[model samples]
Target: MILHGYWRSGASYRVRIGLGLKGLAYQTAALDLRKGEQKAPAFLAINPQGMTPALQQGETVLTQSPAILEWLEETHPEPPLLPKDAQDRAQVRAMAALIGCDIHPLNNLRVLTALRQEFGADQATVDAWAGRWITPGFDALEVLVARHGAGWSFGDRPGLADCYLIPQLYSARRFNLALTPWPRLLAVEAAAQAHPAFQAAHPDRQPDADG
Candidate 1:
């Protein structure tokens, strides 16, 4: 399998973590988002959406981080990312969606760039825009995690929610959002960082990571 992604992309980070947890060894084809490499003709041929986190297995090219994660989970189910019970699985998926769908879309690179190019926003304004969406999403996430989480996001084990949450927290810090309000979520973040899989998949540890 070949994973094509940017170093700092949250969606890519989530897939990396999923691959690590599943103990899947795959080659990486780094597409430097800063250099617009994701939009290159070669990359677009693989993923017409021109998004990072596209997984290639033989002739099959998979796009969308969530879909990739689900495929990984289905193919490699030993270290399962979802819960056994149906209700618990739904809850876990919900928490993951809260971060992946609600929070992340608004703060993604394309959206930020649009804020700057289309609306004449500066860096500070862009950061503020990120915070505006992140803060409220985090507020709700904190409550949800506190309600359902044991050690990780859903239950005692690290699962799908953790995969999504950790990357969002990393992004939150990158945008200078105050994380103190979500102590429960922060604890989960700390636990995730300590885990070997997450440690291996960290942005700083990626081959294409820039200083």
Candidate 2:
């Protein structure tokens, strides 16, 4: 398998973590978002949406991190990302969705680029715009994690929620969002930081990382 993604992309980070947790070996094909490589004809053909985190297998190319992660979970099965219990699975999915659907989208590269190019947002203004969405979403996540958390987001094991949460936290820090208000989420972050899967998936560790 080959993962086509940019180094700092939060959605791409999710897939990296999932692949690591599942012990799946995959090569990476970097699409430099900074240079607009994702929109190039070759990549646009792979994913018409021109997004990062497209997973390519023998003949199948999957776009969208959420769908790719779900596919990983379904196809791999062992070291499952979801809890076996149905209710617990839903709760984990809810936490993942909170970040994936609500928080992450607002801070996507496309959205931020549009804000800067079209809406006259300066870097400082863009950072504030990012924090506006991240802070409240983290507020809700802090409560949910504290309520359901053992050490990780959903339980003691790092599951689906951690896969999503870690990347969002990374983005939050990127935008300079103050994380002091969310102690519970920080605890989850701490747990994930020590896990091998998360360690391997860190943006700084990627082949094409700017740092």
Candidate 3:
């Protein structure tokens, strides 16, 4: 399998963690999103959207991080990424979506670029743009986890939610998003970073990671 991704992409990071947790062996194909390499004709052929975290297995091509993660969980169920209970699965998916959909999309590279290109926002202003979205998304996440703080997001073991959460936390730190308000989130992130799978999947450890 070949996984095409960018070094700092949160969506790619989530997929990396999923692959690691499942103990799957795959090759990495770096797409320099900042350099617009994802839009190149070669990459476009593989993923029309030209998005990071595109997976190639044999003849099949997969895009979208969440869909790839679900495929991983289904194909390799030894270390299950989702819980068996339906309610628990919903909670995990909700937590993942809170980051993937609500926060991440706003702070993603393309959005930041558009802010600068279209709106003439400076670096500080663009970062503020990121904070504006992340703050509220994190606030809601903290509230949800406070009630369901079963050691992890859904339960004691790291699941789908935790996989998504760690990358969002990484992005928070990247943009200097104040995390003091979300103690539950900090705890969950701590648990995730402590795990070998997550540690190995960290952005810095990736072959394309920059110093």
Candidate 4:
């Protein structure tokens, strides 16, 4: 398998964690998002959406982090990312969606660039724009995780929700969001970070990471 992605992309980060946790052996093709490498014809041929974290297995190509994650869980079920019970699985998916769908889309690189180039937003203004969405999303996540989580996001084992949460926390920190109020979420972050798989998949540990 070959995974194409950017170092700092949260969606890519999630897939990296999944691959690490699954102990999958795969080659990486890094796209320099800062240089508009994702828009290159070669990358667009793989993922017409021009997104990072496109996974290619033989002739089969998978786009979108969420779908890739589900494929990973289905193919490699030993260290399962989803819960056994249906209700619990739904809850886990909900938490993951809260971050993947609600929070991340607004703060991704493309949106931030649009804010600057099209909307006349300065760096500070862009930061504030990101915070405006992340804060409320995290506020709701804090409550949800506190109600359902154990040592990790959903339970004692690090699962799908943890994969989503840790990256979002990384983004939150990048935007200087206060996390002290979200103790449960912070605890989950600490737990996930302590795991070797999460550490291996961190942005700083990636081959293409900038400084």
lDDT of the candidates, in the order given: 0.92, 0.93, 0.90, 0.91
TM-scores of all predicted structures: 0.98, 0.98, 0.97, 0.97
lDDT of 4 at 188: 88
Compose the digit string of candidate 1's lDDT tens values, residues 1-211. Answer: 9999988999999999999999999999999898899999999999999989999998899999999999988989989999999998898898889889899999999899989999999988988999998898889988888899999988889899999999999999999888898999999988987999999899999999997
- For model 1, state the Cα shift of residue 41 in Å: 1.0
Tens digits of per-residue lDDT, candidate 4, 98-189, equal 99999999999999998889989987898899899998888999888888888988988989988888999998889877789889999988
- For 1-211, candidate 3 gives per-residue lDDT tens digits of 9999998999999998999889888899998888999999998999999888899987789999999999999889989999898997888899999999999999899999999999999988987999999999989998888877777877788888888889999998989778999999999888887899999889999898887
Judged by whole-model lDDT over C-alpha atoms, candidate 2 comes out at 0.93
Q: Model 3, residue 21: what's the lDDT?
A: 88
lDDT of 3: 0.90
Candidate 3, residue 130: lDDT: 90
Ranking by lDDT: 2, 1, 4, 3
Looking at model 2, how many pairs of residues clash?
A: 0
- Candidate 4 lDDT for residue 128: 90
Model 3's TM-score against the true structure = 0.97
Q: Give the C-alpha miss distance for residue 84 in model 1, angstroms.
A: 1.2
Name the runs in model 2 displaced over 4 angstroms. none
Q: How much is the lDDT of residue 155 in candidate 2?
A: 80
The number of the candidate with the highest lDDT is 2
Query: Which scores greater on lDDT, model 2 or model 4?
Result: 2
Clashing pairs in 4: none
